[model samples]
Target: MKPILLLFIFVSTLFATQYSVIISKKVDVGTLSAQQVRDIFLQKRHSLGNQKIIPLNLVGQEPSRIAFETDVLGMGRDRLNTYWIKQHFQGITPPITQPSHESIKAFVQNVEGAIGYIPSSMVDNSVKVLYEF
Candidate 1:
């Protein structure tokens, strides 16, 4: 029975599809703590490890965006949207945006100081995982 219970927990964890925040290998800040990555993605910080950090994001309606907001930024979708909207009104556009995860990965690879998030399975050697939740 204990083995069955353990298996149940493990399987549930897997199905939860834990998401990860990732960056390009070229940006050598090393793995970021959850809070540090949160600050960067939320646009609260401009630099990390001597590199001027530029946070990239998926489209507003994308599912991964919600997962990233909840898991990494600790904000609800509505609150995040409001936050960005206010930034936009204040003439500060939110981090660079991409239409899809692939585009985000591509942009981060080509640009220095760029960071973004995607599903764990989608990540590859080209990008490095900074944090996971």
Candidate 2:
């Protein structure tokens, strides 16, 4: 019974959700490698050719944010926090944050260079998906 229960939980977790990295439709980027996406979010690479990239983040400790940091940024919470702290003194800062996925979509829709991550279900014709995982 315990084995069956554990299997059920694991399967549910695997299929429960998906994530997407999105950008404004007007930005004109075709596709981005994971490295490029990571660079943009880390503020390591500020632009994609002629387009100025603006990374938007969800507010602290949000599950989607954690997934993004883990899957995309490849950093755990503590390490990422340490990174941002160091960047702060170097005149670099983390991305702008929105409280909810709805706000992320709205900002990306209205702002030309904006990019953010959100649950794949919330996506619509308003934004272009750059990457998904």
User: For each candidate, what TM-score against the reference?
Assistant: 0.82, 0.90
Q: After superposition, how far is residue 1 of candidate 1 from its true place, in Å?
A: 15
Query: Model 2, residue 133: what's the lDDT?
Result: 69
lDDT at position 106, candidate 1? 83
Clashing pairs in 2: none
For each candidate, the alpha-carbon lDDT, in order, equals: 0.82, 0.91
Among all candidates shown, the one with the greatest TM-score: 2
- On lDDT, the candidate that comes out on top is 2
Off by over 4 Å in 1: 1-10, 88-91
The per-prediction CA RMSD against the true structure, in angstroms, equals: 2.8, 2.1
Stretches of candidate 2 off by over 4 Å are: 1-10
